[model samples]
Target: MTIGLMLNALGAGVGATTVDATARDTPSASSFGIGAAIWVLISNLIGLAVGAYVAARLSGTSDNTDGTLHGLAVWGTTFLISAVLLGNLVAGIASTAATSASSVLGGVVRGAGSAASAASNVAGPGGLQSATQGMVDRVQRALSGGGSPASMTSDQRNAEMATLATRWVTDGRMTASDRERLNALVAAEYNIPVQEAQQRVQQAEQQAAEAVRRAEETARQAADTAASGAATAGFAIFGIMLLGALAAVFGARRGTRDVLLVRGTGNVR
Candidate 1:
């Protein structure tokens, strides 16, 4: 495990040096990522192989099955150790996050308490009344739709918009009369010709529909890409693990072969 970690560190150092020494005018981020992953895999395989070989040798096992079992045990041990290390790292991060969240919650609670303490001041003269007046003015300005409606007050426009919105939400479409009514409302509000207002409304509807279609297409494509990426990652993880196991088995077999060589030289059974 130590040997494997050392190899990993050495590879990391070499990779860092290589990146720093690169003179490429247009370096691709993905290429660097792939290189790092490959290096890490190689380092891990080498470490597992060496560890398994040593374990088998120390067990003094000449049997292939025994050697293989030793290698598997080494692999399992190393995997467990790595998992524990990763778990600890995750736990530390969670702790730090929890700490920060608590701090934020505490600040929010303090602010709420301060607000409660100043409730009398908030209820004092010209406070709530001014805020309410400001909100009403803002609403009037919004309902005015960039200016005062040419033939209607802000309240009338607001009521008309609310009714139109309700109709659309409830029935999802406007009838011919509804279309005419909307066109007249727009024409009256902006003092434009009814024909021009109708054209504008049609254009707005088409643009809105197109925007929705494009959004749906983009979302579907994003989902497909995410699924493809996840599948690839899953398969790659399985393949790398399988290769590491094979490396361990091969190393153990070599260790057993070495044992036979020693036995034959010593003239022992």
Candidate 2:
């Protein structure tokens, strides 16, 4: 196991140097692609096989079955240990990342010199008064109904219609009174007849419904595509693992040294 890990580390070192050779040149995208993956896979396979052979040979078992089993045991034990270490590493990284932002913020707040920087711009002079005044202005405007709907500017007319349309979409259907008001707002804002306003509202509603349907369909297709990719990756991983097991068995079997009995070897054949 130690031998295999050492070999893997050596290979990784070599690969790191090879891939980083462009450091002095113009920066480019990573050269680590399918070829890098293949290299890692092949190197790992060799390590496992070599480790398994060493394990079988060291066990002093001349039987092929025992040798193969010994190799398998080595492979399994190595993988189990690796999985535990990987899990711990992953957990540590995740925990640190999750807390890093909060930790920095907490540190900044605890430090007197950094506390001012940590605070929001809302703490500046007149910030509170300005924010409160803005809120009061919005409230007053809402209460005033922004003046009569018909007397509004073009931008105001468009904004009022958009707000009403949003409410209609949220409510799933506009009430008869709301629809009547919308038709009047549309007629006044667009300077069109009531009939045309009603037709425009119908068209907008249909278009919104169609957009929602298309969005739903797109989400479903994306989900299916992701599921398919996951399945393919799972199968590929399974095949690679199976191949590694086979390699371990082969290496172990081949490592079974030929043992001859003293009495039988008396002929020196």
Candidate 3:
């Protein structure tokens, strides 16, 4: 029993890790498709042999229990243990999947930033070009101060404009020129008249926020599916190994009985 347990634990750990690492998006040093196939064959064979031998010896009864039964027990134990451990070990990584998704989004944002810069340079004077670099500096500062004009979901940017406009109107803090410019920014951002632009911004913002939430949910489902498949495959392999071991044990016992009969002169010359 002890030997069977140890062999199974060791095999499960190595097998599960190999499967998990190869399952990632990163390139693997090993030819995982081919290597996994070959390793699975050899590992199953080795596990079967060791498990059957240990089970036969520890079955510890001479009451003529079937060798196949003992062998099946060995395989069943291995499969159950592997499934439990692999599932538990992988649970933590499931939660971190969102972090990987966020990184992908960040890459997309960087690509968009480069495109925006190039387009700005191409448009030159008519590109809604800032009168001076200092104006660009102020926009950058406002964004850097945690109010990114570009990062806002369409609705968020709309909400931001509404708040700004409300302050301009209600607080009497803006010069007429500032309100006009603010109105123009909102128009350019939403592509509508100042009043209509505000409503469109609100709608777009709501839609963009909903889209992001849906995307995150989709990502979570994909991650869960991948994890579940790996675990199921692992358990399936363990079961196959057990079946093979039982066949080996039965063959061994039959061979032993046949040898004894032949040696007793039942059919020997």
Candidate 4:
């Protein structure tokens, strides 16, 4: 039984690796296709069959039914040991894969949180509203040809605009007062007309919406791929195990017949 388990593990590992490598090298080849499944089944069947034959021969059973029963005992013992080992291996692999996926997902979530934080910060004390009011007062002075608010540095103006944009994204839609204030700021900063500033704001909003949609789609695809891979692996494991039992029974019958033939020939001699 132990020998059987070892042989099966080695055969399965090699076959799976070979199939995976071939699929990687072939353009458009699927890793979890029928070929891979067939290889796994064949490898397991061959290993179990060899084990069962050895067990029957060692038992010295002349009756086919007796040999078959011995083979079944061998199969059951091997199956139990294999199941325990496979379960441990699977648990370890699942833990590692889950950790990796969680790390990646967490990174994405953190980035999204950062974006949200930036937007929320705009509503805090001494935030976007205050910044926008300061910029507006300066713009009004500049438009009146005062040349005093022009003393405000370019860095200050840029920071104020960035804060307003972050707030706009989080809010999803601008209030009437925010729209008017933003329009005035843009017109003053770029020397553009108010109508052009409004158009620019609308374009920015559309781009933000598209970005959100893309993020959602990417997350969904990752989840689907993980689910499909898990399902395929589970089904393949079950099928290989079932086929292995059938092979063990067949091998025992063959071994028993061979023993009976040898004994009869000896009597004739």
| TM-scores for every candidate against the unseen true structure | 0.74, 0.69, 0.37, 0.52
Residue 54 lDDT, candidate 2, scale 0-100: 83
Q: Which candidate is the best by lDDT?
A: 1
Instruction: Write the residue-wise lDDT of candidate 3 on 1-269 in tens digits.
Output: 34445655665566556655455754365665555556555555566566665566565533335555676666667667877888987886875787888899999999999998888788686654665566777655444422444455555455556666576547645566545555555775665778875565456547756876899999999999999999999997767665666655663343222212245556563
Number of the candidate with higher lDDT, 1 or 3: 1
Q: Residue 185 of model 4: what lDDT? A: 64
| Clashes per candidate (backbone, < 3 Å) | 0, 0, 2, 0
Question: In model 4, which runs have C-alpha deviations exceeding 4 angstroms?
Answer: 1-40, 57-152, 168-176, 253-269
Overall local distance difference test of candidate 4: 0.73
Q: Taking the tens digit of each residue's C-alpha lDDT, what string does model 4 give over 121-220?
A: 8677668678779989877643442222235455444555666677787887678866766666666677789899889877877888899889889999
Cα TM-score of candidate 3: 0.37
- Candidate 2 vs 4: which has more lDDT: 2
Query: Over all chains combined, what TM-score does candidate 4 have?
Result: 0.52
- TM-score rank order: 1, 2, 4, 3
Clashes of 1: 0
How would you encode candidate 1's per-residue C-alpha lDDT over 151-214 as one tens digit per residue? 5675666667667757864785678876777777778867789899899878876776787789
lDDT of 1: 0.80
